[model samples]
Target chain A: MRSEELIGELTAGLRPVRRMASPARQAGLWLGLAALAVGLAVLANGLRHDLQERMLMPQEVGQWLASVLAGVLAAVAAAMLARPDRSWRWVLLPVPALIGWFGSLGWGCLADLARLGPMAGQIGTSWGCLRFILAMGVPLAAVLFWLLRHAGPVRPMPVLLLGGLASAALCSAGLSLFHHLDAAVMVLLWHGGAMLLLVLAGALLGRPLVMRRQA
Target chain B: MSRTEGEWEAWMAAAQAGDAAAYDRLLRAALPLLRAVARRRIVNPAEAEDAVQDALLTIHTLRHSYEPARPIRPWMVAICERRAIDRLRRQGRRGGRETPIDDFGETLAAPGANKGEERVAAAELRAAVAELSEPQRTALRLAKLEDLPLTEASARSGMSVGALKVATHRAMKVLRRRLGVEE
Candidate 1:
C-alpha cells in the first residue's frame, strides 16, 4: 500500500463506530410519511376551493399555478442535486408532481392576465415589466449556479446565489398573484425577504451535519 | 482484508476491558494511518517519522482517556494533533516563527480518476483558501481546519467573536463560490 494509505489505516486504529439503533430510525420514517400526507391534503383542498371560486377559466388558472409550481420544483431539484439524503428522497416525489400540477393551473392564470384588455393596460405594463425582470433574474441565477460547478458539498457563495435565484422567482410569483399598488417594492421587500428567510432555514437545517463535516 | 464490524467491536471491548495485548494490537493496527497523517503534514521524512513516534507514545500514555463507549477515532485524532502541534512549535521557534501542523487533519479524496485529480483538488482548495485575506484565512484555518471553537479561536487570534464570525462567513462564501456549491 502507499505510505499515506498505510498511515491512514494505522490512525483508523481499532476504533469501531457505534451505529444508531434501527427502531428509532423507523419512528422517523412514519413521521415523515405522516407529514407528506398532511401536505397532500392541504394542497388538494386549496386547489379544489380555488377551482370552484374561479368559474371555468382553465387557461388562466393553468398559467399562474404552473409557473409557481415549476419554480418550486426547480428549487427542490437544485437542493437535491446540492445535497441528496436517502431518507429525504421520498420528499422529492411529490415536489415534481406538484410542480406539474401547479404548472397546469398556472398556465390558465397567465392566460387570464394576458386577456385583461387594453382598458386595464397599466396592469399589463407593471406586471409585464416585473415578470420580465424576475424571469430573467431567476433563470440567470440558476444558470450561474450550474456554471459555478462548486466542487464541495456546501459552500456559501453557491447557496447565496441559489437563495438569490429562489428569491427572485418567489417575488415574481407573489407579485403575479397580488398586485399591491407598489408591486415592485412589495416584491422586493416582502417577497424577497421571505425567500431569504427560506434560504436561511435551509442552511440552518443543514448546518449541524455540514459544520461537523471535514473539509 | 476486511474484518467484520462485530470482530472489530469485540476487539474494542476487549481493549476497553484492559486487555493489554488487545490494546497493543490496536495501537499497532493504527500505526500506518498515523504515519500517513504525519507524512502529509511534516515536510521532512525524518521529522515525520519522529512525530509519528511521539504521537504513538502519547496515544499509549493517554490510552485511558479514550472512552470505551465512544468511537476511538476522535481520541486518536486529538492525540495525533497535540503531538504534531508540539513538533511544529519546536521547529517553528528554531526558524523564528512557525506554522501549526494542525492546519489540516486529512487530505480530501478527489472525485475523478484522472491522474492528477487528487492533486488538482488539493491545489484548488489550497488556492481558494490561500486567496482569503490573512484574517479570514486564519479564522478558517483555526475553526474548520483545526476544529477549534469560535471562542478559542478568538482568544488565539485576538479577533472579537463578531469579527471572527464575519471572517468565517466571508471565507466560507469564497470557498463555496470557488467550489460551486451555490450553483
Candidate 2:
C-alpha cells in the first residue's frame, strides 16, 4: 500500500492506547514480584539452621551481596534493553555486577581449598540445590518475561539473557537464605551452573519464543 | 517540512490519547521523512513505500510505548530502517529468479506462436509498462528494454543498482498482474 493510503487507513480507525508503564516502573514491578516469589520459597523451605553463623562469614556475606547486586543490575539492564531504540550498552551494564558475583564465588573457593582436603572423599554435589535454584528461577523468570512481553526488544538475545540472569541470581540468593551448605563448591557448581544454563537457554529460546511474536 | 522533535513528540503524545486529527497530522508530517529514510535503505520505490507504511503502522501500534519526553525521530528512524532492511533481506532470500526480459521475446517465438497474438500481447505489455510509475518505467526501460547492464542503467538513471533492481522487480510484478500471468 502507498504511504498516504496506509496512513489514512490507520488514522481513520485510531483509538486511545493506554500508556505502557515506563521501563523503570516495569523493572520495579518485576523486582517486587521476584521478592515475593523468593519470600514464598523461603517460607516453604525454612531458613538455614546456622543462618547467623553463615552471615558472620565474609565469604557468605560477599556472595549474598553480589547476588543481590547482580539481580538489581540485571533487572535494570533488561528494562533498558526492552526498548527497540536503546543501544546494546545497557546489556553491558550488568557485567560488573556479574563479575562481582563470580568474584565472590572465586574468593570463597580459594578460602575453602584447605577445608576441601578433609572432605575429599565426599563430593559436594547436591541434587536438591540444583532443584531448588531451578524451581525458584522458573517463577521469577516467568514474571520477568511477562513484564517484558509488551516491550519491543530489538536485541532479544541480550534482553533475555539479562532477564534470565536476574531471575537466577535472585533465586540463588533465596536458596542460600533457606538451604544450609558448608561447601562453597556446591554453591558455585549448582547455583552458578543453574544461572549459566538459564542464560544459555534464554539466548537460544529468546528470538523464537519472544521476538517472533513481537515481529 | 521537518517538524521539530518537540512538536513531533507533542503530536505523538496527543495521538496516543485518541486524538484522531492529531494522529493524522503526525502521520502526514512524518510520511516524507519516513519515505526518505526507507528509500535510503531500500532501492525500490515500491518497496520503500511498503517499508514506510510498515514503519507507520508500527509507530501507531507502539505509540503508547513512546515517552512524551523522548525525541521521536530516533524511534521512527529505527523502525523505518529496520523495516527497510527486513524487506531487503526478504528479497535476498527469495533468490533472484526474476523473469528475464528476453523471456518475453522467447515466449512469442515459441512453437505454434501466432504472429497476431504475439503483437497483441506485446502491445498489451508495452501499455502496462508505460502505465507504471516513472521510476518503475525508467528502471524497466534502462535495465530491461534497452538491455543495459545494471551498473550502466544505474548510471544513466542516477539510481543505485539496488534501487534499479527493486524498480525492475516491481515493474515486472505490475506487468505480470496486468497480463494475467501467474506469479
Candidate 3:
C-alpha cells in the first residue's frame, strides 16, 4: 500500500557479504621480524667489530652497554617474538613502543658517537654523528605510529624488504653523498638504516611467533 | 553478583565442558542471531520468520559439529550468511556468480588500458538501487542492508504484504533495466 514501507523492508534485509579478518597485521609482524633480526645482526656485529679496540671514553661505556644489551636482546629474541599473529590492530601497536624504549636508552651512545678526539676528528671539523644516530632511531619510531594507524596494509615482509633494498641503494648513493662529509654521516645512515630495518623485520617475524603461541 | 570477564569466560568453558545448562544458555544467547540472520535475506515478514525458525532447527542438528575452543561468531555468521544467500537465490534473483562482459568500465572505449572492467560493473549494480521506484528501493535497501524482515517492514510501512512484494519486484525490475542485468 505504501512506498515508504517497501523501502524499509529492503533496507532492513541487508547483511555484510564479507567476514574475513584483515591479513596485513600478521604479515606486518612476519616482515618486521625478518628485518629486526638482520638489523640486530648488523648492530651486534658492528659493536663486536668495535669491541676489540682499547681506548675507553666515559661516553663509550654507554656504547659498550648498548652492545651488551643487544647481546641480551638477541639471546631472548625468541622470547620477544610474539606480536604479529593478531588479527587486530591494537595488539600490534606495542612493537614501536618497545623499539623506542631501546632507542631512548641509547641516547647516551648516540650523543657521543661523533666526538672522535684527534685523528678521527681531523677527517672533519665537528662531525654531526649524533644527528645521524638519532636519525636512525627516529624514522622507525615514526613508522610505528604510521603502523598504529595501519599504513594501507603493507605486508611486513615487503615493507622491510623494500626498506632493505632502499637502504642498500641509498648506501651507494650515500657513500657519494657522504664522501666529502664525515664518518658521522656514514654512521647515521648505517645505524638508522639498521634500526628502521630491524624494527620492521621484528614486526613481520613476530607474527608467526604470535600465531604459534595462539595455536 | 557482577558478571565479570572471568565469569563470562568461565561460562564459555563450562559450555565447552559437557554442561547441559551452559549449552542451553548459549543457545538462548543466540536468539538474537536468528533474528539477525532471518532479517537479512527474505523480504516478506512471515517468510523471514519461518526461515529463522528453520535455520535454528538446522543449527540444533548441526550443534555437535561446533567445536568448543574456536570462536563462535564466525560459526554463527557462516550459518546466517548462507541461509540469507539461499533465501535470496530462491527468490529468483539467481545466485551470486561471476558476470559476463569482464569489464564494464573498460567497455567505455578507453585508450590503451590493460585492466578489465568487472570492478566498474559490480559498482554499477549498487548504484542502480537508487534509481528504482520508492517502494522497491526501500524494500531492496532494507533487505540487503538493514537486514530487516518483510513483516516487520510491512508493519512499519503500513503496506499490505502483497503490496510490499510488488514493490520489491518492481524495484528489482528497474535495477535490471538500468544496469542491463539479465533475468
Candidate 4:
C-alpha cells in the first residue's frame, strides 16, 4: 500500500498511550534495582568485617564516590544513546566520570601497595569477587536492557554498550559495599574485568537482541 | 506540514498522552517529509512509499519514546532513513532486470508481417522462454515480461538480487542465441 494510505489506516484506530519514563527516571529505576540486588548479595555473603572503619576512610569513600558517579553518568549516557537521534555529545557524558573512577581506583591501589607491601599474593586470589560482580551485574544488566527495549534504540551497539557499562559500574559499587577485600588490585582486576566483559558482550549481542528487526 | 519545532514537539507531546487527534495531525504533517526522505534513498516510487509506510509504523510503535521536550525531526528522519535502506536492500536482493521491450518493437512493427507470421514469432519467443530453467524463467517473467524492478522481482521470486541478475543474464543469453539476435 502507498505510505499515505498506510499512515491513515495506522492512525485511524490510534488509542491513547502513556508517556514513557524520562531517561533520568529510567536511570533512577535501574539504580534502585541495583541497590536491591546489592542488598541481596550482602545478605548472601555478608558485608566486609571493617565496613564501618572503611566507610570512614578517605580512600574507600573516594572509591565509592567515583564508582557511584560513573554509574550515574553511564546511566545518563545509556538513556541518551538509546534514542537513535540523540546528539553525539551525549556519548561524552560518561568520559569524565570513567576517568575519575579509574583514577580513584589507582590512588586506592597505590595506598594499599604502600601500606601492605605488594598485592602479589592477592592478585588472582579473589576469583570469587569476579563471580560476585558478574552475578550482581546480570540482574542489573537485565533491568537496564528491559528499559532500553522500550526506548527502541536504532544503534543498539552503542546504547547497549553504555547500558552494560552503567550496569557494571553500579554492580561494582554494590560489590564495594559487600566484599571486604581492601585489595584495590583485586577490585581493579576482577570488578573491572567483569565490567569490560559485560560491555564486550553487549557489543556482540546488541544487533541481534536490542535492535528492532528490519521491516 | 512545515511546522515550527515547538509545534512539532507540542503535537508529539499530545500524541504521547493518547490524544489520537493530535497523533493523526502529527502523522499527516510528517508524511511529506517522510516521503521526501524515503525518495532520496529509493528510486522506485512504490518502494519509496513502502519505506515511508514502514517508518510511520515504527514511529507509531515507538511514539512514547519521543520525549516531548526534544525536537522530533531527528527521530523521524532516523526511522525514515533506516526503513529506506531496508527497502533498498530488499530490492537489491530481488535483482531488477529493466531490459526494455523496445528490442522486439521493430520486429512486431514490420509492415509486411501478416497475422500468421506474427503468431509464429510470438510462439517461438514463448517456447524459447519456456525452455529456460525454472529460476531463469521466473526471473525473465518478473524482470522482463512484468517489468518489475529488481527488488520487487526478488521479493516475488525469493531469490537474492545477485542470483536473479545472473539468472536474467543467462536467460537473455539463451534467448539471444535461439533468436539469433545480436547483444
For model 2, state the Cα shift of residue B4 in Å. Answer: 1.9
Candidate 3 residue-wise lDDT, A59-151, digit = tens: 334433443333233212211221122233333333343344345434533444546443344333323333332343334333332332222
Ranking by TM-score: 2, 4, 1, 3
Cα lDDT listed for each candidate: 0.51, 0.79, 0.44, 0.79
Which candidate model has the greater TM-score, 1 or 2? 2
How many Å off is the CA of B136 in candidate 1? 70
The true-versus-predicted C-alpha distance at residue A136 of model 3, in Å, is 20
Clashes of 2: 1
lDDT of 3 at A54: 16
lDDT per residue as tens, model 1, B17-135: 55555655666666666777777777766677777777765554334323344456554555565566667778877876544455444444554434466788889999888889999
| Candidate 1 accuracy as TM-score | 0.28
Q: Which DockQ value does candidate 4 get?
A: 0.32
Q: What is the DockQ (computed on Cα atoms) for candidate 3? A: 0.01
The CAPRI category of model 3 is incorrect
Sorted into a CAPRI-style docking class, model 2 comes out as acceptable
On residues A10-111, what C-alpha lDDT tens digit does candidate 2 reach at each position?
A: 999888888888888989988998888888889898888999998997867887988888998899889877776777688888788778878877766666
Off by over 4 Å in 1: A1-19, A22-48, A51-196, A201-215, B1-28, B41-183
Is candidate 2 or 3 superior in TM-score?
Answer: 2
Instruction: Put down candidate 4 lDDT per residue, B106-139, tens digits, no spaces.
Output: 5556666647778889999988988899999999
TM-scores for the candidates:
0.28, 0.72, 0.27, 0.67
